[model samples]
Target: METAYTIRKMEKSDLDQVHEIEQLSFTVPWSKESLLYEIEQNLFAKYMVVELEGKVVGYCGVWVIMEDAQITNIAVHPDFRGMKIGEALLTFAIQLSKEMNAKRLSLEVRVTNYIAQSLYKKVGFTVGGIRKRYYTDNQEDALVMWVNVQ
Candidate 1:
């Protein structure tokens, strides 16, 4: 049988699981404390988690500032990759941004991460520029992409 998944606002209780996916997905993961601060203290931040069978399986975060929304981070648990969870999370973020009156949505993906770049492109993002050595893990460059969501 197939498992069902649902996406909802991120809560303090979800940090541990969200951090787990962050560690699994990135070379430099954000600390759990940072996640907590974003959820609890950051006024411009919005985060959502995808739960599979009542367990957090993926998450995405965005910061809406004025007319633009910038995706801060997004990840799916290693065990949940290739299950369309990432796409759903991103799609939801886009909709949420629009509802918040954002006219454009943007994100940065590692230049070498072609799979993620393709996925972003598939969802209407286009390469806008490059941030040289944007990633501290290995000094990897990041490609900035954006889409008009309004």
Candidate 2:
């Protein structure tokens, strides 16, 4: 069954939950302060959150520049995993990128994260390249996946 949820532009107040999900979902998470900067100061960055029953359950960030949009992060709360929220968030991101007039949308995912890679592949993304030692904590290679939106 599809979950009822709301996806909206992330606000300053969402930093706590967003950061919480970040910490829970990644080996090296973005700090609350950095998320605040992205919300308030980054000109090209757009952050969004997904709420389930009025509580934030996931978030995604993207930097849309000229003809391209790059996804910075996307994660669902640990408790909410497998509810399809991440896929919803990703679909929203791709649509958002197209609405922003970006011709392509891309993101870097740790090569070992087959779950996320499969989700991206389900959404028309194809492996484009690799970033050597892209993850700081484990020195893991990241696969660059991209989809043409235009």
Candidate 3:
């Protein structure tokens, strides 16, 4: 049988596992304190997690502000990369944005991250602009992408 996974709103209890995935997936991962603040204090933040076999394996975060939504970050456990979890999570974010009355959603990806760009394109995202040296880790430029959600 194929493995099963579920996507749901994130909870404080999942922080440890989410932090682990974040660390494994990004060169610059958010701190545990930062995650907690986003979940508890940030009014615009909406975060979701994908669980596989009862373990948190991936997460996506977005900030919805009035008519515009911004995708802050998305990540999957490196071992779970090929399972379409990222696609599902992004779709969920778009649907959530729609429900929140957002007219558009946008995100920034490292210029070198073609894999992520392709996935975003699959979900209807197109190039919007670019940010110079958006990533501090290696000073990589970022490609801004956006999609109409309404």
Model 3, span 1-150: residue lDDT tens: 567999998999999999999899889999999999999999999999999999999999999999999999899999999899999999999999999999999999999999999999999999999999999899999999999999
Best by lDDT: 3
Off by over 4 Å in 1: none
lDDT of each: 0.94, 0.94, 0.95
User: Which regions of candidate 2 are displaced past 4 Å?
Assistant: none
lDDT of 2 by residue, 56-124 (tens): 999999999999999999999999999989889899999999999999999999999999999999999
lDDT of 1 by residue, 1-150 (tens): 666899999999999899999999999999999999999999999999999888999999999999999999999998988888888988998999999999999999999999999889888999999999999989999999998889
TM-scores for every candidate against the unseen true structure:
0.97, 0.98, 0.97
**Clashes in predicted model 1:** 0
| Cα-based RMSD of candidate 2 | 0.7
Quality of model 3 by C-alpha lDDT:
0.95
What is candidate 3's CA lDDT for residue 125?
Answer: 98
Candidate 3 residue pairs in backbone clash: none
